[model samples]
Target: MTDAQLSPLRAEVREFLRAEIDSGAFTPDVDSWMTGFDPTFSRRLGERGWLGMTMPTDYGGRGRTPVERFVVTEEMLAHGAPVAAHWIADRQMAPGILSNGTEQQRRRYIPGISAGTVYFAIGMSEPDAGSDLAGVRTRATDNGDSWTISGTKVWTTGAHIAHAMVLLARTDGTPDDRQQGLSQFVVDLPHPDIEIRPIRSIDGQAHFNEVVFHDAVVDSSALLGRRGHGWQQVMSELAFERSGPERYLSTLPLLRAWSDHLREHGATPNQRVTLGRLTAQAWALRQMSRQVARELSDGGKPDVFAAMVKDLGSTFEGDLVTAIRDASGIVPRREGGTHLERLLAQSVLHTPAFTLRGGTNEILRGIVARGLGIR
Candidate 1:
C-alpha cells in the first residue's frame, strides 16, 4: 500500500501521542529514542499494539509490513516519545530472534517483547574493539552442552534493566581471527556471573554500561544463529540498525522547540530561510529512510543505501543542533531554563555522539566506499 493508504494508522498514532501529552504523561524531548526510558509509556505503546508491528502474529506481533512499522516508528521518534525502554528489542532483537532463534527461544521471548514488558541490550562493543565488531576479544569456552563466557562488553546500552542481552563473543578462535569463530548468545540478565557497571556520559546519564561475563554459563540453546556465523548475522543487523528514522531524527526535538519558540516570538527572514532549508532536508531524509524500509520489505539488502542514510543522517543531526542555536543566538542552559534552552543544552551535549554511535562517520564512509567497489 502507498503511504496515502497508511494515513489512518499515522493519524491514530498522532492522536494517541496527543492524548498522552494532554494527560501530562510526558514532556516531549530531543533524542527520546536514546534518552527516554519510561517503562510505563513503553507499556502503553504495547497495549496499543504498536510495539511489534512487523513480527509474526504467532509471536504476539501485529504481523504488519515493514512499511507499516516504519510509519509507527517515524511517528514515535518525530514526536519524541519515550520509546527507549522497548526500542532495542522491538527494533532489532525481535527480527533477529525470528530470523535465527530456535522455536523455543521465540516462544519464550517474543511475547514479552511484544508486550513491552521485556527489554534487551546490545552487547557487541568491547573495550578493546569499540565499534569494530571484528576485533572482539570476548571469548566463550565450549563445555559440551553449554558455554562459559569470560570477557567484557563495553558500551552495552541498557543492560542493567534489560531482561536479557544479545552478546557477541569469540567462541572458536583467537582475537586474530577477525571475523571468524565469532558467535552470539542470549544472556539472561541479573545472572550471578554477569556484572553490569554503568558508564555515565557527559550529560550525567548512565545510558551506556560495561557488561562483564565471569565464566558465565549459558545452555547451547542460548546461541543465536549458527556457530561461527555471527559476522554475517551482525552485518545484516547493522543494515537494519543504521537505516532507521532515529538516525536523522535524534535532534528533532531541538528543531521543534526552536520552531515553537519562533511561533511565539517571531523569526527574521534569514531564520525562516534556514529553518525552511533544514525542514526540507529532513523531509528528503525521511523519504530516503522510508524507501530503505520498502526495500527491506521486498527482501532486498540495501546496506549501501542504509549506510548513506546513517552517514548523512548523523551529520544532519549534529548540524541541526548547531544550526538551531546559531540561528537563534540563544545560550543553551542545562537546567532551570526555557524549553528551547534546555532542549538545546541537551542537544549540544549529545551532538558529540551523533556520529560516533552505531558506527563512526569514518567507518560509515568506508562502508559506502566499499559498497561502490571503490576500495
Candidate 2:
C-alpha cells in the first residue's frame, strides 16, 4: 500500500497513544523497545491487533502485510510506547517459527505470541561470540529422545523474564567448519538446569542477562527447523531483527521532544540546520527499512540490503542523539528532570549499543562487502 493509504492506520495508532499518554498509562521513553518492559502495555497492543500483524490469520494474527505492520511498529517506536515485552517475539521469533517450526511448535507458541502472553529471548550471542556468531561454543549432545545442552550466553536480552529462548548450539562438526553443525533449540526458561543472572547496563537497568545452561536437557522436538541448520536460520532471523523501524527510532522520542523544545524556545540558525539534517537522515533510513520490510513480506532475502539499512540506521540513531544534545545544550539528567532532559539522558546512555546490537557496524559492513563480492 502507498503512504497515503497507510495514513489512517498511522492516525489510529497516534490517537491510541495520545489517549494512553493523556490518561497516564505510560510515559514516552527513549529506547522503550529495549528498556520498557510493560506487559500490560503489550497486552493492550495485542488486544488492539497490533502485535503479530503480519503473521497469518490462522496463527491468531491479523494477517496484515509487512507495510501495515511497519506502520504500526514505526508509530509505536516514534511515540516511544512501551513495547519491549513483546518486541523480540513479534519482530523476530514469530517469523522465525513460522518459517521453520514444526506444526506442533506453531500451535504451541504462535498463538501466545500473537496474544502477547508469550515472550522470547535471543541466544545467539555468547561471551566469546558477539558478532562472530560462528565462534559460539555452546554445545548440545544428542541423547536419543533429548539433547543435553551446556554453556553460557552473555548479553541475552530479557532471558530472565522470557518464556523461552531460541538457543544456538553446536550439535556436530568442527568449529573450523564455522557455520556447519550449529543447531537451534527452543529451550523453555526457568528450567532446573538453567540459571539466569542480570547484567546491568551503564544506565543501571538490568535488561540483559548471563544465561547458563548446566547440562540442560530438552526434548528432541525442541529443535527449531532442521538440526545443523542453525547458522542459516539465525542469519535469516538477524535480517528480520536488524532491518526494522526500531533501529532508527530508538531515540525518536528525544528527537520529537527536542523539536518541540526548539519551536517553543526558538533556535539559532546552526541549531535549525542540525535539526534539519537529522530529520532528513531519519526519513531516508525509514524508507530504506521499509523497502526491506517489503522484501521480507514477499519472501525475498535481502540480507545485504538489510545490513546496509541497519548500519546506516544505527549510525543515524547515535548521530541524532548527539545532534539533539548539542543543538539543545541540554545536560542529561537521570532523575527529577524535564522530559527532554530525561530522554536525552536515556539516549546518551543507550547510544553505545545502537551499532552493536543485532550485529556490529563493522560486521555489517563486512557482510555487505561479501555480498558485493568485494572481498
Candidate models: Cα lDDT each: 0.90, 0.92
Please report, as a residue range, the 10-residue window in candidate 1 with the lowest summed lDDT. 253-262
What C-alpha RMSD separates each model from the true structure? 0.9, 0.8
lDDT by residue (108-206, candidate 2, tens digit) is: 888889999899999988888898999889999999999999999988998877999999999998667799999999998789999999999999999
lDDT of 1 by residue, 1-375 (tens): 797999999999999998888889998888888889999988988989998888888999988899999999988988888889899999989888898899999999998999999999999988888878899988888899999999998888789889999888899878888999999899888899999999999999998899989999998889998999988888888888999999999888788878888899999998998899899999999999999999999988888899899999999999998888888999999998787898899999999989988988888899899999996
Per model, state how many residue pairs clash: 0, 0
Candidate 1, 45: how far from true, in Å?
0.8
Off by over 4 Å in 2: none
Off by over 4 Å in 1: none
Error of 2 at 205 (Å): 0.5
